[model samples]
Target: MRPMNNAPLDTDRPNSLIIAPQWIGDAVMTEPLLRRLHARGERLTVGALPWVAPVYRAMPQVAEVIEFPFAHGGLQFRERRAIAKRVEGRFETAYVLPNSLKSALLPFLASIPRRVGYFGEARVGLLTHRLKNPKSKPPMVAFYSALSGESGFDADRPQLKFSDQDISAALARQGLPVSGYYVFAPGAEFGPAKRWPAKHFAELAASLDLPVLLLGSGKEAELCDEIVLLSNTANNAKCLSLAGKTSLTEALCLIAASRACISNDSGLMHVAAALGVRQVAIFGSSSPLHTPPLSDQASVLWLKNDASYQSPLDCAPCFERICPLGHTRCLNDISAQRVRDLL
Candidate 1:
């Protein structure tokens, strides 16, 4: 974790603290709002979960980052009270990002003058200013920006700052070439339904005839290994499974250096988009309308399964982690040839 800035607050500047979202993609989407807040001359501090802290720390817009120590879905009321006490009377307002009642607890406990968030989880008294969530889900970027009273379907793409020196160092450390490589993100933290088939990815990598780097978290290392093996057999080209090998910052730099990136709808896709990497994002069991990559360089392909395989669910975007029907035709229907054509 980066050391917290303990500098005295500027009295002339209005201080604001944002309770950041936990998910990596949602955390990336929050950048536009942070940028706008900084532009308006609000000294910004982000309260982030431990895992997602790197996202805000990379942003120049953030003045400071406070690591929220509690585990996801774990209340830890005493811990919240301790945190509130530590940062008491520091900020004039707090922007609560998550809808959970637990998310609003710290700000309310600290007695921050203004608390703003959507009405959810019976948090009526916790928030001083309650915004109603839209009935229909909007793109996360627009939805988050709207919290600050900014109205738009579009916002500036999420940008992360990294030095070329850092990128070169990361590449050297991983024994990877500096350029002429394509990245494939085959892991989706959401569930298997959001992931493109491993066979399809292997086929695509084989046809590309370029160095392929597979990026993912430690959990996806096995999956990436399988793809690498299959790809090597198919094309006899170099395919390295770098899953779990690089840090988040290293992964960001690698994506920035790639010729192009092909990924399932996942956090790395958002990171690639943020870095202005040309990306082909595949979607299944989720709606692009809800959280599409906020980059003009991105091309999205959605494969919807209209026919029911076994379960009775008729909708294409079931939004469930695991497909209810058990058959993932939504992902299976997208051919390797189609994805290769995009590349």
Candidate 2:
């Protein structure tokens, strides 16, 4: 965690503390909002969960990235208050990205005059300024950009920047040459409904001419190992599972330097898109309309929109962690050949 701004607030220039989302993809989606804030001469400091802190670090507009020592579920009132005390008068405003009531507590407890976010959960009183929550899901980029009190951002795209020298150093540590290998992120934090099968990923790896590196969090190590094992059995395909081995920073560097990236609708998919890498993003249970990769280099493969798919996926975009119908045809029907053909 980076040190807090203990040296009193600099009131000359406005500074805002951002309460970032826990999910990696959602953190990436918030970049456009940060950019807008910085453009207006606001010094930005992002308070992010440890897992998603690296995403904020990659954004040039962010002045500092403070990893919050908080966990999933519950309020953690004592923890929030303690951290809030340290940053009490540091920010003029606080942007609570997540809609949960607890996400707004720190800003409120710190006495930030302007606490902005969507009006959702029981956080109505926690936020000083709130926009009524939308009736339906909107594009994530546009959803986040609205916090800046700006309109006509429906067509905006989020972007991330990394130093070329830093990327080269990270790749050298991994013994990978730039653009020499392909990246495959097969794990979706959501659940199996969003994942492309291990066997399917192995088949795609086996068909590719270059080496494939499997990337994900420690929780997904076993899943990625399954892909590596399956690929090895198929004509000795070159597949390496570096899921738990590399840090998120290293993974971002790898994705930035890859020949191309292939992923399910996972966080790394958005990372690849923000880095402006050529990528083929596969969508299963989720709709591409709500959270499509906002990059020109991205090619999304969602069967929900395909006309030739047998018995169109009407049950798609269910957004469930697991398929309720027992059969995950939405993902199962998407073959390895189809994904490989896109690349």
Candidate 3:
């Protein structure tokens, strides 16, 4: 799917284009920097952001995606110069994962020789190979796998492929019953201090007896129909919201046929930690050492305010979307039996 129009820069194999990450959990942590640039053979494409372009079209180390029509944080500039004149000469290298000088203005207006990224805002001459923004906040899959020059913080975790007839036609179009369920994801598009209390996810879906879907976006479908009416008023469990009724590749094929997902450090908790599933992930106002969930089979709770569940608020992770000490005691003292004893 690579033709966005200026097609002719294939120069024998080492391609790359990237420029993704306009959220959906930083484009699922740029899939271990597109699996370290497709394990060094480098053919990836990306540019995304039509709501994260189906997460780089379900990434098989991306060969092509390109949507980027611009709007979120809109600078427009003749619509990013008509998407840099339709990707001017296909791509030699661009990378640039959102530090926003309009995300390095379309690989410095598509001359794309070697753009690369990370010198935020002022974007000094729009990056010819910038780097240097790391003074500590790491783990965003080792901050995009250290922009693929790699050097080990251990990478590979965001995987995603899907198709068993698209997870059985998205669980028979969300009538959802293909497997024993449990997928919560209680909404946090970076606000409400990385949200966690939808009545503590409706009392941990009425103490987990299974069948619980939830998921998000259509502005979290009235907070997932108020956690499916507060987990069906105490326990007839089958709680289902299917928020905004599916589609981000059918919510990654219903979090790849969930058996466990819980979530809240959003983007379907990094797509249920890239479908290795069994996640838990909560965190508050964000910080699992800067975006954790590269899944060691996932399980992080991190409520901050000096962890053992609340009472220190020296602004716990105060990355602040709304809790300017508005007492989101780091996500209201994190309990629901400490997320149902990590299930």
Candidate 4:
């Protein structure tokens, strides 16, 4: 974890200001990176957004968490500048994770000695250790882990460590079956376009011989309820709707207990990858190549434009919410049968 010269990082002399990733999911994805940074020394602090503070509130890897009070993608030079002023004398190196040019300005303004990040918007001189974004990133876990200059990992391998007590606690909370149960995550926050058909989820539940737990945020509450209600079972007892129930950290514990996670390409899906839980990730209106799950057990199902849905729109890869065309062909055309086949 030595920065070139192997000198001790200085909080009193010069500390490291590490800019965190945006979104809980992205921040979760970068955990390995944080661990590597932590190994470097004990004086590293994270510069993160106010909303996403919960993601790393208790990470053993972070010494201090610096809150940046401003909307993501908004101009908060005042806020950023203020933070820069506060961290001015401490940071010797800054690791900027987000690709935004503005994300780099803080450490630069703080006048940190060395800045480390990908070479984006041509901030060559600003960052001292400009890592060339790898040509072939292994898996999600190892991808960011390279920042530590020691990426010994397997892309197909899932690798997050937790305590035995935590595992037992999570399973106990889940009410362990005589036999283990399957898990379903039926919603994607990026948009409804990423969601599978609700009735199809119910059908999937019915098809499974084991018990099920459905999980997601309150945003996916209706979708979860629909899945539970639509299941035409004797008691719908097989499916336990855990959606909107667990906190993100709690959900991580549960996903660790799951045998497999069937999900849309969403934060939970990324969580599956990080946890190295077996995953069946379905993709539509998006390219798997750009955002493929970085796990060997992580399988992806994406739609290629066929005659029925020719023309992958100019805005097709726009990654926008509420498709402008309103057709939702990307997801609508996807069938439950496809998901079943993967499962």
Best-matching candidate per TM-score: 2
Number of the top-ranking candidate, with lDDT as the measure? 2
Q: Candidate 3, residues 175-207: lDDT per residue as tens digits? A: 777768888888887688888889888988888
Report the C-alpha lDDT of model 2 over 1-343, residue by residue, as the tens digit.
5566465566766989999999999999999999999999998999999889989989999888878889899899998999998888888999999999999999999999999999889889999999987889689998999999988887678898889988999898989878999999999999999998889999899888899999999999999999999997874758999999998999999999999999999899999999999999999999899889989999999989999998988898899999999899988888889887777
Query: For residue 255, what is the lDDT in candidate 4?
Result: 76
Better of 1 and 2 by lDDT: 2
Worst 10 residues of 2 by lDDT: 1-10
Write model 4 residue lDDT over 38-145, tens digit each, in one string: 665546677777545546654566667766776756767887787677667676688888767788889888898888777788677667777887777545556556
Off by over 4 Å in 2: 5-8, 235-237
After superposition, candidate 4 runs with Cα above 4 Å error: 1-15, 35-44, 50-73, 76-88, 118-158, 170-179, 232-235, 305-330
Query: Which parts of model 1 have CA positions greater than 4 angstroms off?
Result: 1-3, 153-156, 305-315
Q: For candidate 4, what is the lDDT?
A: 0.70
**Model 4, residue 296: displacement in angstroms?**
1.9
The sequence of per-residue lDDT tens digits that candidate 1 reaches over residues 1-343 is 3455665767989999899999888899989988888989899989998878878877898988998787877789998998888788888999999999999999999899999999999999999999999998677887788779766636467887778898899888988787789999999998998998999999899888779999989999999999988989877758889999888878888998899999988998898889888899999888787778878889888854334344433557888788788887778878889887777
TM-score of 3: 0.36
**Candidate number with the higher lDDT (2 or 3):** 2
Q: Give all TM-scores, in the order shown.
A: 0.92, 0.96, 0.36, 0.73
lDDT of 2: 0.91
